[model samples]
Target: MTPGMQIRLWLRQASKTQVGVTAVALAGVVVLLVASLTTGGHHRASTSVAAGAGAATNTGQGALAPATPEGGTGTAPVAGGTSGAAAVVSAPTTGGAAAVPGAGGTTAATAAGGTTGATGQTAGPLTASDRGVTPTTVKIGFLIANVGGLDQGGFALGLRTDIGQAIDAFVDDANKHGGMAGRKVVAVKRTEDPTNQGDLKAACDYMLRDQQVFGVVDSASNIYAATQRCYTIDNKTPLAHVYALSADFMTAGGGYDMTTTPNLDRIAKFVGAAAKQMGFVKGGEHVGIFTDACEPSNTVIRKVMAPAFKADGAATVDIAQTDCDPQAQTSQVPNAVLQMKTKNVDRMFMATSFVGVQNFLTNADAQQFHPKYFASDYDGMAADLFTKNFPPTQWDRTQGISSGYSGWLRAGHGLTPAQKRCSDILVAHGLPAMKDDAANGEVISQCDAFLNIMVPAAKAAGANLTRAGWAQASQRLGHVDVAGFQSCTYAPGKYSCGDSYASVEWRKEFQGYIQISGYRPANA
Candidate 1:
C-alpha cells in the first residue's frame, strides 16, 4: 500500500484511547516532511523563529553577533545562529530595482506592477498599489485567537483580547498623529481556533486574498509557521509581527518577527546560568524537562535545554513528554508528576503550553511534590493566572525568563514611559482600568511593534507602497529602541530582532513575578 493509504489505514485502526496519540504522531510526520522540504537540506543550527521571543535553540553563549548590514549576505549570530537571519536585499534607491530571489528561488516580486524597471535589468518601483492601500487609507489584517471559541483550550483569552484592543488603540493613535505616510491606518481583525488548521488557513486566505491586506500581524499561535507556509510564502505578503515559536518563519524568508524572546539555545543558557546563580545547580541538582509533544518548537527547546542544563552541572536529567490536547494532558499530568517525583527531580524545566504547565502544577500540588520550576514566557506563567489558579506556595517556587522590561504592573514596580503610554492608549480605546496582566504585556508588545517598527518602515517605503517595498523598508531598520521597553534590529540577512531577556521569580508579596536580574543580553 502507498504511504498515504497506510497512514489512512493506521488512523482507521486507532482505538478511541489511541486517537490523540495517533494524531500527534501523524502531525509530527507531516511537520518533519515540511521542514525537510522547506529547509532544502540546508538546515540551520537552530530553529528559533525570527522576531518574537520564546522558541529557542542553543546559541553557544548568551551574546549574539552584530547584524549583517543592508547590502551584506552574512547572517546575524543571534539566539538561533545563521538561520535566524533572513536574507533581505536592499531596494534600489537611485534609478530602478531588480527582482530579488525569495526563498526556494521563487521570484520575490509576483504581484501585479512589480515588474522590472525601465532598464529591464533591475526592477522598478511599485505602481499598482491597490492591494490594501488607497489614497486615504491603508488596510492591515490581524489574526488572533478566538477567546470564546471551543478551541480556546489553555490559551489566555484575556491576553488575546487585550492585544486586539491595543491594535485598535494603536491604529486610532496613528491616525490622530497624521497616520502612516498620509494615509489613515485601518485594521481588519479575524479570529481563529489556533488548534484547527482549517480555521488558520481560512483566516489567512480571507485576509490576504479577500481582504487584500498590505500585511498581517499575528498574535501567538501554535500553528503560525504552517499558516506562513500556506499563505505568505507563495503570495509574498509581508507578515509584520508574529508571536509564535517556530524558527521556520525567519529561515523561510519573507517577513519580519517582532519577538523579544531569545532563541532556544539562549534560553537554555539563561536557565542554566540563572539556576546556577540561584543555587539550584550549585552541587548539581537533579533536573527534569517536561514538554508537549504537539508543539514542534517545544520539542526543539526541550532537546537543547537538557544538554545545556547538563553542561551547567545538572546532576541528572530526566524527561517526561505529554500531548497538548487538553483532555489527554489532564490525564497525563499525574503520571508525569509521579515520574518526576519518583526520580527525585529537584529542579524541573517546562517547555509546554500554559495549560500544560497548569495541569502539571495542579498534579504536583496534589502529590505535595514542590520542585522549583523554570520556564520561558511562552509557557503562560503570568501573574494573574498564578494568583487565580495556584496558591502563593505553588507560584513562589516558579522562576521564568521574560523579554519585557517589567513584570505585570505592580505598585512598586513602576511602568516605563512606553508601557504607561500603552496603558493610556488602551484606556482611551475604552478598556478602562486594565489590570496588570499578561494581556497588558501583549498589548504593549504589539503596540510597540506598530509604533516603533511597522509605522517607521511604512514611512520609509514612501508613496505607492507595495508588499515588496514594505519588506525592503523593514530590512533597512537595522536597530531601534522600542519605546524604552526593549531594543529591536533587522538587516539584510537577520530577522530575529531582540537579543536579550531578564530572569524573573514569582513573589507572593507583590502578587507577580519580579525581575531578579537586569535586562541581560543573550551573551553572558
Candidate 2:
C-alpha cells in the first residue's frame, strides 16, 4: 500500500484495538523493551511488558549474547552463519571519512603492532581470513514512523519524519566525507504500523530475513520492540535506536541498545526537583501527579513519578490518570481541571502527550485551575499544538516550562568533527536546512558505540563476529561515554544524563525554560 494509505489504515485499525493504541500512545516506551533481543531475549522483554500489566509472566532469554564455541582460536572467521568469525570491518570510502584502524593488522600506511593497555586489552588480531581482503560493505536500515493518523495526529510522524529527514542529511554528509571505514553508508527506508507489534515483527523480519541489513535505526518505541525482537531473536540483527525512551532499549541486559535518553526517569526527576524548588518559595507542600491512564505510559508514569514524588518532600502525592483514548483529550482535560479544583494540590506534575497536555492546560486556563505546571519534555509539543488550535497568547498562562536533554545538535554545540563532516555532506546533498534535525546523528552514535567496542573485540579474539562474535563483544557494551550529553551503562543498563533535574516556573514576568542549579544524582 502507499505510505499515506497505510498510515490511515493503521490509525483506523489502532483505534479499534486497545493494544495498538497503547503502543502508539507510549511509542516511546515499548521501543525501549524490544529494540534488540535474541529469541530468548525477546521472550524476556515480552515478559517484562506483560508483567507491567500484572499479567502472567512468560520467559525469554533476556538480551544475552550467544556463548563462545570450543577452544582452538585466537580470532574467529568473518564469514556468515555461526562460524564465530570476525566480520570484516569496512570504512565509508566516498570521501575522507577514514576506515577504522585495523586491529593488530598491517595496513599499507600503519604498523600492525601496538602495546596492550593496562586493562589487558590489546588491539584485535586479524585471522588468516582477513588477509589481503577488503571488508564487505555493511548495510544499515532506517524504519521511519512517518505515517499520518496512525500516530494520532502525526505525533510519531513528526518524530520519525523530522528525525529521519535529519538523519538522511547526516548520512549524505557522511558519505560526502567518506562513509564509515571504506564502505559507503546506505539507508533503506521503510514505514510500518508501530502500534501493532505483529506488523512491526513482520516488517522487521523482512528487513533481516530478506533485505539482509546488518543493523537497524528507527525512531518509534513500539517499532523498537518489534524490531529488536526480530533482529535479536529471529535473525540476530543488531540495532541502533534513535528516540526510544525506555531504559531497556538502550541497555545491554534488555537485548536492545538505543541511542536516545530514557526520558521518563529524567523527566520525573526534573518535575520533582522543580516541585521542591517551587514549594520552598510558594509554600506548596502537596504534589499532584497526573498521567494518561493508558498502557505503556502508565507503566512509565509509575516508574518515573513514584520515586520523584517521594523525593519532592510532598506531604501527600495524589495521582490523576487520564483516558487512554486519544480522542478523550477533550474530555480528560476538563475532568482533570475540575478534579484539581476540589483537591488541595500545592503543585502539579503531568506525564502525558502533547495534545493531552494542551487540552488540560487550555481547559485549566478557561476554568482558572492554575497550579504550578511542571511536566516532561514531550510537553514542548503542546506549545505548537496550542498555537495551531488557540492563539499564541493563550499559552501565556502556561509559560515557564523547562526540560533538557544531553544536548541539541540542531541548537548547535560547536559541532564535533564527525558532526561537522556529516553536516557538510547533508548540505552538499541539497539538504542544507535539513541538517538541523540530527536524527541520524543519534543513530550514528549508537552504531559508533557498537562498532567502537565490537570491532576491537572481534579483531582481538580473531573470531568472525557472527552472533558469537557479537556476543563476545557484548561483554564490554557497558559504561560508554557518548560525547558529552550522557553516560550509558549496560552493566546496570540505566541512563544518567543532562538536566537530570530541572524546573521551569511561570513567573508573572518571564516565560520559558529555566535550567535548575545544584546538581545531584537521583539515588544520592
**Alpha carbon lDDT at 242, candidate 1:** 31
Provide TM-scores for the models. 0.69, 0.60
lDDT (10s digit) by residue, model 2, range 81-167: 111112222321112121333332233211333222214343343222221122323345666553444345334423323445555
Weakest lDDT window of 10 consecutive positions for candidate 1: 1-10
Question: What TM-score does prediction 2 earn?
Answer: 0.60
Number of the top candidate by TM-score? 1
lDDT per residue as tens, model 1, 283-346: 6688887654443344344445666677778777777755433344446767788888888888
How far residue 21's Cα lies from its native spot in candidate 2, in Å, is: 14
lDDT of 2 at 360: 59
